[model samples]
Target chain A: MLKISGINASYGKIQVLKNVSLEVEEGSIVTILGANGAGKTTTMKSISGLLKPNSGKIEFLGEDVTGLRPDQLLRKGVALVPEGRQILAGMTVLENLEMGAYHRKDHDIASDLNKMMERFPILKEREKQLGGTLSGGQQQMLAIARAIMSKPKLLLLDEPSMGLAPLVVADIFKIIKEINESGTTVLLVEQNARQALKVSHSGYVLETGKIVAEGKSDELLNDSRIIEAYLGRKSS
Target chain B: MLIEQLINGLTLGSIYAIVALGFTLVFGVLGIINMAHGEIFMFGAFIGVMITSTLNAPLWVAFAGAIIITAIMGYMLERFALRPLRHKQGVSHLAPLISTIGVSILLENLSHHLFGAGNHPFRASFAEISFQIGSITVYLVQIVIFVISIVLMITLSFWLGKTKAGKALRATAENLETASLLGVDTKRTITMTVIIASAMGGIAGILVGMAFNSVTPQMGLSMGLKGLAIIILGGMGSVRGAMAGGLILGLAETFIVVYGDSGYRDAIAFLAIIIILLIRPQGLFGQKIST
Candidate 1:
């Protein structure tokens, strides 16, 4: 489980995430949904320690993880498939996956790599091709697969559905479900509230760095206010 | 005579290429122009001289010591000088260039103060020997230096291609944030990059010292300029481009030195770079460089 309370983040003088709080239970998909500039991405970044919070407490698996560097967070089995699918463009598909397990000392990396290939058969075909050359949908899958390569306990996905075709988006969400079912907790950030809520166990709505609503996925999906503001229902 | 000139040019070209490799690698990866890189190259030669003379180490030991020491120094510079400027991208871009220049001046003065201003002949006993191949005379020292340079390049290529650390370095070069998210220590990776680049420069310094049998404080500045030319000619970040550019520059300089005029050697080398840039600004093998 991961717990974050009273987290504040900023870029220069402009504050991004103000007193934001959230939680993710073990082996469940927890999504943060918001429109543009709702500080969803910033929240994920703060949890991953890419952006140091001015004041807050972040607990990952019952330990204080605030202010840890991104790499350190990864070593402690936390990984993020960052926004825009920042795949290493110059590297090959195999090398990118290898990068995911960089902190591990285990000798079964080859087996794990093969497992990733089995999960995403398309990647196996392009193992030797440069990552930049992959199609957008493939790149998104590769990003998530690459994250799973670390054997992470908590996987933070920011906008995985962005810029992909509908079919690819469905395929990616299916894999995310399978990944969650196989015992990894996921913190997904998305503007696609409909799809995100469909797969998530729980969801939260963020507005201007503040948490506005939180509950079970189906409840949030059908709530009159949630449907009006986020679920695309016209207001009465 | 032509054969002799070609061989000589290749050897010298390889040296320039080595230094250029350092320049291009650092510039390509970090997007920082480490003006201090030349000083690091100079320090390598000085370190070589110290190991061989003061420590009474053998040629191989001196060479290894020079690279390792310079690498550690490069890591230190990245950790202390560059990492602090990470948040300020605009400032970070210029800080390394300025700080590197300051470091270069500081080293040049330090070398002057410590080793004295006089030029020192770094005479390794190996310099006196040579093996003749027909009309072409190959000094054992030159052969050794060439072999060392080739071996180092091969090792670097392999390390960049086949190793975990290398993959991580490339990842960082492509996207630092993603690399960190994937469990790569971006700070450490950048430091490792500086170390590798500085080590390459260090080896270049030793090769130059042994080949020419002389080392000076200001020599690095000129050599550094030549390295920059090689990188520009080869394209900024392409590894193959660096080697090819270095060889081309070397051959051009050699031909000018032999057939055209001695004084025109530098001029011709620089002119060739301009011509190449005008024609293919990204060099022969490099991708189009983004400003």
Candidate 2:
């Protein structure tokens, strides 16, 4: 389990995440739903160690990991699929996946790589091709697959559904479900509230860098009023 | 005589190629122009000369000494100069480049103070040695420079493509954030890059210095400018492009000096770069990145 308590993060003078707190139980998908500039990405960045929280604590299975750099968090089995895909454009898809497993010293990397290939069949076909050449949907999948390659205990996905087709988004949510079922905990950030709630065990609505609502996914979904009240005009 | 000229041109090309490789390496990783790189090349030459003339060391010792010293210099420059500028909040993208320019100026003046801004004659034992290759005379020094240059280039190419460290470097070059997210210590990778690049530049100074039998504090100015042309002509971040571009510029300059005149020598690389950019803006081996 990962616990973040009242973390405030910023980019210079501009404060992004103000007193934001959230939790993710092991082996479950926890979704953070928010619109643009809601600090969803910042929250993910803070947890994944890309951006250090100015205040508060981030505990991974009960150890303080706040202020640790990205690479260090990766070694502690926390991996992040950052927003924008950010795939290595010049490198092959295979190499991107290889990069995911960089922190591991285990000898079974080849087997794990094969498992990733089997899980994401399209990636296997395009293994030799450069990542930039892939379609948006394929790139998102590759990004997710690449993160999984690290054998991470906790996977943080920021905006996995952004700029993706509805059908592709559905496929991605399905893959996230399968990934969770197989035992890796996922912390997902998305704007697609309906679909995000559909797959997630629990959900939190983030607005203006603070948590506005938190509950079981079904409770949040079944009560349209609660979703509408917190998510405002953005939730569908 | 034509064969002799071609060989001489190639030897010169090899030196240019080595110098450009250093530029390519740093540019590929940091995405910043290190103006100090040229001074590193000049210092390498001066170090080699000092090792040879002052200490009376062997040619190989001079080469090794230059590499080690320049590599350390590379580390210090990156650690002290570029790294701090990199992390400072809201710093302009041009900040790192400007810092390098400052460092270059400091290095040039420092070398001037120590080496007296005068050209020092290289003291290689093989300076007088040469052999006949069927109507062409090749000096021992030229062969050494060419062989060393080629070997270093090949080795560097191998290391960048096949090694894990090389892959980490390329990954960082492609996207620093993603590389770190995937567990690459990008900070260390950047430092390592400068060290390697500086060593290459330094050793190149020796090879070029040895070939010309001279060392000067201000030598980096022209050579660094040639390196910039080669980087542009080769494509901004492509190592292979730098190598190919350097050789092209070197050969062009050599043929001009042999067939035309030495006065027009320095202008050739830039002219070629301008022509190449007009034809193919991406340079010879650069990828077309959308701005």
**Number of the predicted model whose TM-score against the real structure is largest:** 2
> Candidate 2 at residue B252, lDDT?
89
Q: Which candidate number maximizes lDDT?
A: 2
True-vs-predicted CA distance for residue B11, candidate 2, Å: 1.5
Model 1, C-alpha of B225: deviation from truth (Å): 0.8
Total backbone clashes of candidate 2, pairs 3 or more residues apart or in separate chains: 0
| Clashes by residue pair, model 1 | none
Model 2 agreement with the true structure over B67-159: per-residue lDDT tens digits = 999999999999999999886788999999999999999999999999897779998987999998888899988888889999999999888
lDDT (10s digit) by residue, model 2, range A129-235: 98989999999999999999899899999989889998999999999999999999999988877888889999988888999889899888866665565445564
lDDT of 2: 0.90
Model 1 score (lDDT): 0.86
Worst 10 residues of 2 chain A by lDDT: A227-236
Runs of candidate 1 exceeding 4 Å displacement: A234-236, B50-57, B88-92, B288-291
Q: Residue B50 of model 2: what lDDT?
A: 95
